[model samples]
Target: MLIPAVAARLDPGWASRVAAARRKLWLALFHPRTVLEAFRGETPGFRPHRPFWGMRGGVSAVFVERLLTLLTALPSVRINPVGRLRHMASGPRGTVLLDFAAPPGGAPQRLSLPAATCALGLGAEELFRAAGVDYAPQRLSVAFGWAEVAEADLRHCPFSLLLAAPGAPALRVSAGPVAEGGRRVMALEFGHVPEGLPHPGAAEARRALEETGLLREGAPMRLLGVTSLPCLQVPSFDNRRAFQAALAAFHARGPEGWAGQLLCGAGRLGFDSMNEQILTGLRIGEP
Candidate 1:
C-alpha cells in the first residue's frame, strides 16, 4: 500500500525547514549506521548524538581530497585544473559539447563527449541560466583550523565545553582528535566570523583552549593551519526552485544526464557531505 507519511510531515511555508531538518537527521543517523553495517557487518543501533558531530563537527576535507586524488589518477578522467567552462550544449549522438574560455596567453578549447561522461564539480547556476534555465544559489563563508592537543584531553572534553559564548566569534570547538600529517589535532571551526576580524592566531587559540581546560595554562601548542570555504550555499525557496528547474532540464536531455550533478554542489551547507554524495552517486548511478 502507498503511504503518505512523508507528505503528512510536510506543511506549507514551513515545508523547506522541515525537509531540511529531516535530511539533517537522516544524514546524521542513518548514514553512519549504514556505513557500520557495511564495513563491520553490524548495526550501531540508536545513538544519543551523531558520533562524528562532537569530534569532527561534520566536516572532513581529507575524505573529499582523497576521492579527488583517486579520480585524477584515473587515466580516463580528463581534469581541467585551470580552464574555465564558457559554454555547454547538447550535440549529436547523445554527446554534450563544452567550450572553455582561453586561459591568459592560451587558445580557447572545445570538447564533445557522452553526456554521462561529464560531471560538474561545482554549482553552475550561470551556465544553466545561459542555457535558458532559471537557477540561483545563495552561499555563506566559514572557516576551520587545526590545533595540536593531547589526545587524552580531547577524548575527555565534553561537547558542552567546546561551545562558544553567545556572542563569541568561534562557532564551536571539536573535542575529537583528528590525525593530520602524523600529528594529532583538534579542530576549531567558525561560522559568521566578522568580515574584517583577523583570524585567531596561536596565542588566541591557546587562550580559548585554556579557558575550556582542553589545554593547560601556558602549555605549548601549535596551530596546525587555518582555511576558509567561501561558497557554502544557504538554503531558500528561490534556490530550491532554481535547482529543480536545472534538474528538469538535464532530465529532458537523457536518463543519465542528471548524473553529473555532484552532491558537494547540491547546495548543502557543509562540504563534508561530499563524501556521502559521492557514495550515493556510485550506488544509484549504476544499474
Candidate 2:
C-alpha cells in the first residue's frame, strides 16, 4: 500500500537518470585503474569519469570492495548492460530511491532520495561518506504509514514500546505491512531524528498516528521485525576479519535470535562471497 502511494509521486524522468547513474557506478567499481586512482587521489589523465564525485576525496580499496559487496547483495537492484542499474529499497516507513546518471561534460552523478515521508539521517550521511561522495538532503511532502495501525495495539507494538523505553535514542519510527512475493509481513522502521528538530517522543508520534485513524487495533498482523540504516565501519582494510566476526556473531545468535543484519560492504571479509556467509543472518519474513 505504501509502495503504490510512493510510486505514484515519483518523477517520471528519474528512471532514466537512475539507470545512467547505475551504469557509471558499475564501470567505476569494475575498472581497476579507476579504483586505484580513486584511492590514491591520482587522476590518470584519461580516467573514466568516476561514477560518484565523492570518490575523488580518496577512498580505501577495502572500502571500495565493501561498497561493491553491499551493492551486489541488495535484493532490489537490476544490473543491465553490465554498468547501468536501477534499484529501490522499500519498507513500511518509506522508500529510498538511488538514481545515477552522467551528463555531457559533467561528472557521473547519483541522487539518493527518500520517499513515503522518510528523511535522510546519519545512516544516509555515513553511506555517502564511506563512498566519499557529497550529497544534499532534500525534504519531500509524503505520508508516513503509521496511521494504518490500530490504536488498541499501539501500546504493544515495538515501535511504541522502544520509543517509550528508558535511554532509547530519539528516533522517528514507522510501521506497516509489506507484501513480499505471496506473503505479507510487518515492517518496523527506525530512523535518527533529523538535526535541530526537537526530539518528538514516542508518545507524541503514537498520538499523532492514533488521531489520524491510522492505528487500527485489529489488523491481523504478525511477525514483528525491525531494520535501520546503521553506520558500519572498519578500523582498517582487513575485511576478512570483519566477515569472520560477523559470521561468529551470526552463529552465536543462531537463526531465530538474530533480529536483523547490516547491509555492509568491505572491512575484514575481503572479497568473500556474502551470499554464502553474511546474508544468511537476515530474517526476510516469518520464521
Candidate 3:
C-alpha cells in the first residue's frame, strides 16, 4: 500500500509522529553500531519514572539491536513500511500490519516491541503492550513467498548471472547490470544465511571465489544489508562468469546441489542505498 494513502486516513498531526517512529525503528534495526554506546548502560537523563515516550525514550538500544539481529537472521522476515503508522511485516510464520497511535498529552511509555509477538505467533496487543506503545489494531492481509515474488519480478527484467552455492549457510553471489551516471555498469552482491552449518573461512571462501571468475581481480567490495550479517557488494566481475554456467559449476561439486536451490533474479540497485540514508538520518540521539 502507498504511504501517503495510509497517512491520509490518520489524524493530521499523527502522520508526522508515526513517520518519526518508523524512521527511528529503521535506524535501530539497520545501523546498530551507531547506537551501541546508548545501550552500554542505563542512558543518562532517561528517567524511567517519568512518562518517557517514543521509541528512542522507551526502549533500550541494546534491546532494539538484539531484536533486529534476531529477526533479520530468521529464514523468513520482511519489514515493509507503508507509512509512519502503517507497517507490513511478514515471515514464514505469518504477517502483521502495525498501526500505531500516540497517547494524548504525553509520550508513549514504550516505543518498540519484540519481533516474536508479530512475526512468530504472539498477538498484536501483546506486541504493543511489551513495547509500551498505544495503538489500534486492524486486520492485515498477507501474501506469502517473498522469494517467489522476487523471482517472478526479475523473470522478464534484464539482469546478469551470479552463482549460488548450497551449504550449511547457503551463499548467493549477486551480479547484474546497474544504471550509473547515464551509463550501465556491472555490480556484484554476495549474501549468505546468517545461521546454519559451519562454512568455509573468509580467506578460503575468498580464494575459492577468485578461482570461479565471478568477481574481478581486486575489485573493491563494500558491505551492505543488515549489519549483523552484511552482504558484500562488488562493483565488477570477471567476464567468464555466466549465470547458468555458475549454477552448473556450483551444482556439479555438491550432492546438496548448492544448498537446496538456486536463486535467479534481477538485482535492484540503489534500493539499499536509499534505506541507508533513512537509517542514518534516524540515528539515536538526534532530537
Candidate 4:
C-alpha cells in the first residue's frame, strides 16, 4: 500500500544547510505563485482554483493532469503534497534516503525507499546543481504582463502567437483569461537578454504584440507584472554530455546509486516531449 508518510528520519541541521545551499527562498521568489499554480494544476487532484478558472493555453498542464488523475487512483499510491526536498543520498539495505523539510516551520523529515522505487523529479537546473551536478542553463525565460483584454473581445485572437522583429526581442504571447469577477490578462514570454544587455522593457512587448496582431497599435498596455527565470534548461550537446557523465559517476559508486534518478529537463524541450516524460515517469513507478 502507498503510505503518505515515509519510514525515515533526517537531521535538522543538515537539512537546514542543504535548504540554504539550494536557496529555497530564491526558488520560491523566482517562481511566483502564478507559475506554481500552473505547475500544481498538472498534478492529480488538481481542482482549478476560482481565480484560475477559464485559463487556457497551457496544453501540457491539461494533458498531464488528466493522465496523473487516472494513475493516482490505482491502489498502493500515496501522495505527500507537503514539504520541500533538501537532499538525497544512498542508504543501507539497497534503499535511497530522501531528506526534506515538512510543513510547520520547515521541520526536518526523511523518506527511505528501495533504490529502484525512487525517482527524482529534480528537473529544475538549480535543483540539479544543488544536488552536486555541474551544468548550466541553455536558455532563460522572461515574462511580461500587459493590459487586460476581455476574453469576449479577443475571441478572434489565437490562443498563442510568436512574434519576432528585425531589431526587437522575439516573444510568445499566450492568453490566460481568468473567470468573471477576476482580473483577466494576457502574458508575454521571451528569451532572456544576454549578459550586459539592458532589459527590453514592456514597450518592446507591446510593440511585438501589436506586430503580431494581438494588440492594437495605440492600446494602453499598462504593465501588470514582470518575472524572470534565469535557470531554465534546454537540451544541448554539452548539457547532455555533462548530465550523462554525472549520472554515470553517480552510478559508479554502487549499482543502486542515484545514477538515472534525476528527472532532468533534457527531453522536456516542448509540450510533446514533456507529455512523453510524464508518461514514462508514471510507467516506471516514478510518479
Question: What are the lDDT scores of the predictions, listed in order?
Answer: 0.54, 0.34, 0.30, 0.51
- Candidate ranking (TM-score, best to worst): 4, 1, 3, 2
How accurate locally is residue 136 in candidate 3, as Cα lDDT from 0 to 100? 34
**Index of the highest-lDDT prediction:** 1
Please provide, for model 1 over 1-287, each residue's C-alpha lDDT reduced to its tens digit, 9 standing for 90 to 100: 01122221121122454355334211122354564564587755656645544213334665567668998999997666435666777777777777777887777888776776565554456455435565565544566777887554442455434342443435456654345543356677654334576766676567667766666677557888877665445455565666666766745653334345444453333333555567656765688
Displacement of residue 112 (Cα, Å) in model 1 is 1.7
TM-score of each: 0.56, 0.20, 0.21, 0.61
**lDDT (Cα, tens digit) per residue for candidate 2, span 150-189:** 3344443332222222223322334333334423222222
**Model 1 stretches astray by more than 4 angstroms:** 1-84, 100-109, 116-136, 148-169, 175-184, 194-204, 222-228, 245-272
Comparing candidate 2 with candidate 4, which one achieves the higher lDDT? Answer: 4
Give the lDDT ranking, best first: 1, 4, 2, 3
- Lowest lDDT 10-mer window, candidate 2? 20-29
User: At residue 87, what lDDT does model 2 achieve?
Assistant: 30
Tens digit per residue, CA lDDT, model 4, 49-119: 34323324444576557766976897877766536656667789888777776776556778877786456
Candidate 3, residues 1-287, lDDT tens digits: the string is 23322222221222434332332211112134423544566444533445523333222454567767897888787643221233323223332224444445533232233334321122333333322334232211111110101221221322333232332111222333333332222222223223453333443334333445544444443222121222222112221133223334323432221122111110111123433434533542167
Model with the higher TM-score, candidate 1 or 4: 4
Q: Select the stronger candidate by TM-score from 2 and 4.
A: 4
Of 2 and 3, the candidate ahead on lDDT is 2
Model 3, CA-based lDDT: 0.30
